[model samples]
Target chain A: MKSVMIVGVGGQGTLLASRVLGRVMLDAGYDVKVSEVHGMSQRGGSVVTYVRWGDKVESPVINEGEADVLLAFEQLEAARFLPYLKKDGVVVTNTQQIDPMPVITGAAVYPEKLIEKLEEKGVRLTALDALSLAKEAGSQKAVNVVLIGAMASSLDIPEALWIEAIEKTVPPKFLEMNKRAFELGFHA
Target chain B: MKELLQGNEAVARGLYEAGVTVVSSYPGTPSTEITEAAAMYDEIYCEWAPNEKVAAEVAAGAAIGGARSFCGMKHVGLNVAADPVFTMSYIGVNGGMVIGVADDPGMHSSQNEQDSRNYAIAAKLLMLEPSDSAECRDMTKLAFELSEQFDTPVMLRLSTRIAHSRSIVDTVDRVDVPLRPYVKNAAKNVMLPAFARPKHEMVEARTVKEREWAEICALNFVEDNGSATGVIVAGSVYKYAKEALGDTVNYLKLGVVNPLPVEKIRNFANGLDKVYVIEELDDILETHCRKIGVEVIGKDLFPRCGEFSQKLIAEKMGVARDESVSIEESIPVRPPVMCCGCPHRGLFYALKREGVYVSGDIGCYTLGASAPLGAMDACICMGASISALHGYNKARGAEAEKKAVAVIGDSTFMHSGVTSLIDIAYNRSNSTVIILDNSITGMTGHQQNPTTGLTIKGDPTSAVDLEALCRAIGIQDVQVVDPYDLKATRAALKAALTAECPSVIISRRPCALLKTVKHKPALTVDTDKCIGCKACMGIGCPAISMKDGKAVIDATQCVGCGVCTDLCPKKAIG
Candidate 1:
């Protein structure tokens, strides 16, 4: 069985990214279960989704230290959910910063040197500026697709399957841009 | 075809396949998507009623008219509809009636962590709890059959985990069951003393027959692994137990949680040396087993609150995993907040400045109780704010009326708030009420309400006028102000507090996140004129932050609501 944890702020298309992954896994004949956050928690709050796929999956949630891959949409969120990663797990993170409410309200400061701090934890990291890549591809919202592209390398699934899933999951109007974004992150 | 579906979506599909002709529901977390998904089917007539009670009544009326009908609500929403739910059990249904109530055991987005199973038992209703998305579909289809067979309303209980989680569900074709012809039978339908007494006896007799059916029902079965230790579980917890214990332990998984199969449970327990009941929240099964003189382990080892995970079950059962690690550093909490351009932000900010003790209601405005804005004093449930403020002022007399106000949302006012407003006027209480009219239901993903002039499928309809409604309800003072206009909102609030009669101030604005609402260009902070006063920060807008002792607005995050500009004493924010 393999477990992937997707972590990001609410309304960041993290759920869409997980949905695309779930479709790819399901199409590949794996039993997939995806658990997501909904309602109030989706209002600019920390959102975490658990996607597990295998011959037969049972629990919908991934426990601490059980995730094979951690897909982070933001730098701070990457560090926040680092504990869920297995010792030898791969981290596919986007180097983007969205300050928490406390930081915005001046009650707390945004953490510094997040990547260095995560490196000290000993997990293999593939960090990139997915926002820039997505912008170059024509839309900033495609950052999730870009991160999904980076995450595709960590799994045994083929790049073509990921692209096919992306095409099916995203709307046709922005299909070309998202495809460009995914390819850029795949080779970044 | 097989598709990945959330439990709610599967239930909706099940309703569609069951040939349900009528469906009604109120928007609530974990259960909202059922009706939303049902609205997609052209064959079914789906609508969002004003409140859960109305939803239940609509479905009940439809069933009485010879149509297979369904209604859904969250845990607390069931409470609002409980009056009819309890009596509907005795009256029964002419056509199949299925009620979907999703319980939040963890209180994830609810005010309380309530067990909906207690309602099933108290009302003497038949209840089925599905473990996953597949069961959510199959059991829903089965629930309708059971409802028609027993002539009772079937409760399909769902929890947060089961409702939101996604799994593969095999597709099924629609089965067109002919609706039973409606006949006016006073002995069964009417609840007068003479008729209700006999109906109550019939309900009890039905329970006995249902218990017998449950003992041999296909929904309740044993998986004999020939293990000495056995675990009896239901709902989503069964999946966790199977994942944790694997095939090492025998299992008795129950799909029909209420009127629990007593004989089946005893037979399964007798076959094992030891038995355990695994359930989330209150241990209804454990209590039932003990009453039947069967020894079982439950609740004593497991927690009575919050949802359970596979790891928790494994640890409690002393089962070891392949890998387990603990981290020392505690992660900082990321609490949900109002959106960047939220209309409620400015209203709460103005209320705080006015020094009014706000009694809030459910919806996005409940975030007003959070820090920085800290305007709301209490929030109990849907539409409780108006009644709570009325009683609060009645206790403290006229002095308290100046300090207290009730804050409710547009959808909520239509739900149950209108009655409370009438109560205030009839009782002659000098309480002030602020209706945060955000154009649509802000929470639960912007579903259309009566005030929005749109139906479940976005068809234009008659919009409820808030000012006219309040005036018609004997409220002499009815005023409207834009929440974005901070000065006007504050002035209206202050005037309403001192008004001799009950008054309602409508703080009207469209939700910032609404697709139909257009946002202005993002605001910019002038660094040259900026002095670090931290006044704009008090509004708690996520887009506004302080950088190098001066306020800075993130253009990417800001929607240019410009409510923050009113708070800046220096006028640095534009």
Candidate 2:
């Protein structure tokens, strides 16, 4: 089983990542089940989407120390969800930070040196300047895709599967850029 | 093949697959999308009622007329519909009607984190909570089936996480589960005391029978682990239990939460060395276990409030709380606030300055009750401000009437404020009501509402004219003020509050955060002529701040509506 958890703030396209992963797994001939934490997602709150795929999948939630990949769209949120990964799991994350409600309200502070801490724990980590990369891709909002692209190497799923998933998930007008974004994620 | 869909869309698909013919709901987060999704299907007759109660009644009426029906709202919506819901429990149903009330455990878009589970118990209806999109769909389909089977309404409970999240739902072919033909029975449908007394007896009997039925039903299942320790949990939290306990603990995962399968639970707990009842927010399950002579760890072990994660579950279960998982320390918190170019900012600033007792309602305007603007004195629930304002005036008389103003949102006013406005007009409380028409349900991710002339699925719908509605309610003093036009908004607010009769001021502006609305160029301060009076800071625009003895605006962040232009008394800034 290859389990992936994507963590990001609300409106960060975390859902799209899961869909793309699910499609990729299905294309690879594996059974895939994707789940998500919804509701307050659009409120700029901490949001996570889970995708579990294998020859056959039973549950959507990845058990503790069982996630094969952790794709994080924000630094603090990645730190917040770091526990989902296995001891030897790889983490691909955006170096950019979008503070959650608690941070802006003075109730908490954004954890600095998060990637350093993750690296120290012997977790295979790749940090990309996702916001800048998304800007380079002509949409700063595509940061989620930038982080998703960084995780493409491990997927081993066909490019077509990713395309189909992106096509199904995004609205029709946004399809082309999202395909390019998927390619970016796949190539990253 | 599973298709990608939004949480709301899947629930709609679930209803469609289940063959629901009638759908009615008032817009709300986590729940709004369900009806919106259902509306897209021509087979389903969907409408947005003025309030939860009306929506519930309409669904109940459809069920009475022999159609499987559904109504959805946020948790607070249940309170508004409780009267009908409780009565419907006694009356039962003809066609199955599933009522969805999504609870925001962390108060994500609500004023309070009240669990809808308690309402299920209070109303004596079957309640099922879906843990994810699949269950959100599956349980919704099942809810309709169970509702008809039990001759009762079923509550399809959802949380913020389940309602808004996307998941892959493998749906079955659409089932044409229509209601049997309706035949009105005066003895049953009409609840005179004599008729109601027998119906009440039937209600109690039905609950007992439902519990017995739940024990054998597929909804409540015992997942045996060959372990002595057993855990009973339901809804989304059930996923947490499954994740944290692994192969060590057995579980009695109940899908139908109401009329809980006590015998089956006791049977499952009989041989266990320890029992734990895990749930989010409340101890309804824990209380049931304790009442039925089963000892279990719940609220006392885990915190009573907020959502839970797998790590929290492991810690409470006395196991390693993810020893391999490392969290970054010293992370800063960022509380949600109104967006930088928010239209409500200046209006709230004026309210705060005037020191008025503002009874706030739900929406982005709720952010005004937070720090800086801190204008609103109270926020009880949706559409509460108008009624609360009336009560305040009645209690405190002239002084209260002079200082207090009821602040509500355009969408919220359309949702439930209309009735309260009617009340104010009928009684002539002389209370000032301000409808902050940001042209969207801003709190719940800017879903369109009646005033926005848009449907939840982005289709064009009839726009409810607030001024016309006020006029219809017989309020002569109705004015529209652009909230971004601070002088006009302030003047209108002042004038309305001073009027001898009940009046309404519509603070008209599209929400700044709305993607459809383009923002003006970011305002810049001429540093050469800048004198830092910090007057612009009074409005609490996040983009404008005092830096190095001069008023500075972050160009990258600001959506320049020129709001701060008037704030600088010295005329040195902007």
Candidate 3:
């Protein structure tokens, strides 16, 4: 059984990324269960999605301490979801920072040195400027695909399967750019 | 073929497979996608009714006319439609009718974490609950059959996790089931005193037979792993228990929640060393176990609060979860906020400046209650703003009228706010109602409403004219303002607030997320001349942030509505 947790702020394209991952696992003949957060939470709030696959999966929830991999799309969200990661779990995080409401309202501060702090904890962290890589591929919206490409480096799935999954999951109009984004992040 | 489908989507597939002819629903979180998915199929007729009550009545009328009909709504939506639902329980159906209600146990997008299963019992309706997408599909199809076999309407209960989660489901072709002939039987349909009295007896008799059938149904079967710890669970909680304890604990898994099998649960609890009734939000099942003289460890061990998870279940049972690590640091919470360049911002900013008590309704504009642009006061449910504002004024007399105003979205105004507004006029209160017309249903992913000038399928339709409707409702004072135009909006709000008679201020602007709406280029800050007084942050736009004592705006997030530009004291924002 394998569990992957995708954490990001709302409207950051995490839902589409989970769909691509779900497609990949389903095509691999594994029973896949993916949980999503929708409605009110999608309005610039912290959002988490769970993707699990096995011979037969029971629960769609990936609770605290159960996630094998944490794919984070922002610095603060990455640090916030660290508790969900297993002891030896690997983290693929994008270095982009989006201020939450409290920080904007001067009620709190955005924590600094998140990547350095996580690395100092003896955690295996793969950090990248996914937003920049996505920009190189033509749009910053492809940041999700770029992170997926980076996360693929630690995953055992074939490169061909990842591409196939992207093909099936992404819309035709933006397919070429997302593929470019994936390639750039995969090699970075 | 097996495909991963969300539980709500699977319910639509089941509706299609069951040959449902009419499906009506009002857009609510978790339950909205069911009708949206059903609309994808060409055979079924789907619609976005004005409100849950109208939706239920539509479904009930279709069923009475001999068509398999279904209505879907969030738990609170059931409260709106319960008037018709309770009577439909006795009136029965000519064909088959099913109601799909999804509860928000953790109040994810809902005002309350109400247990919808209670509605099933109170309404005397048979209820089926599914844990995953596959069961969502199967139970929906079975619900229709069970409804027809018992001559009653069936309710399918789902929680947030079950409604929103994706799980693999085996696909099957739609079955061809012709509708039953519509027979004229007023004795059963009409709810007159004499006729309804007989139907009430039939309902009691029906419950008895359904309870008997519940005892041996395959859906209530037990999985005895011969373990001493027995857990009686249902819906998503059952799946979480399985994931946490696996086969270490014996399980009495139930799919039929209402008209619960007492004898089956008693037998399952008899041999176990410990019995735990684990349910989310409420002790509906636990209370049932005790009524039948069964000793079960429930609510005492499991707090009747938020959603239960695998880790919580494991910890409660003295089982250990996998080890995890995190750096010790406090993180700021990220609550949902209004999108950048939201139309509601201008009106809310104006209301905040005026310091008026803004009675609010359910919608994206409810985020007006959030900090910075905090404007709204009360938000109970759909259309509660108008009526509540009227009552507030009537309670305090005319002084409260100018101090308070009701604000509702265009979609919500059409949903139930129209009647709420009518109450203010008919009762002759000096209340001012502001209709935030974003031109679409902004909350539940932009489903078209009666005010949207489009159908659920995006077909052209007649849109409601707010100004004309207000005139017809005997309100002579109707002011329209562009929410993007701060000056105009504030002026209009002032006029309505001071009006001698009841009046309305319509703040009109399309939602920023709508594709048809064009945005100006992202604004830049003239940091060289900026004082960073933080005046622009008053609107709470996510795009603007501070760096090195200067305001900076991210191009990716800024829609350049220039609401912030209007706020900069030094004119630093462009």
Best by lDDT: 3
Cα lDDT of model 1 by residue, B253-326, tens digit: 99998898888999999957889999999989999999998899999999999989888999999988666333
lDDT of 2 by residue, B191-281 (tens): 8999999998888998988888888988788889899898888876777777677879999988888988778988999978988888888
Scored by DockQ, the top model is 3
After superposition, candidate 3 runs with Cα above 4 Å error? none
Best-fitting candidate, scored by TM-score: 3
Better of 2 and 3 by DockQ: 3
Q: Which regions of candidate 1 are displaced past 4 Å?
A: B322-330
lDDT of 2 at B309: 64
lDDT of 3 by residue, B11-36 (tens): 99999999999999999997999999
Q: Write down the lDDT that model 1 would get.
A: 0.91
In angstroms, the error of model 2 at B60 is 0.6
lDDT per model vs. reference: 0.91, 0.79, 0.92
lDDT-superior candidate, 2 or 3? 3
- For model 3, residues A1-188, the per-residue Cα lDDT tens digits are 99999999999999998988998999999999999999999999999999999998988988778888899999899899898888888888999999998898888999989999999977789999999999999998899999989988888889999999999988899999999999988887
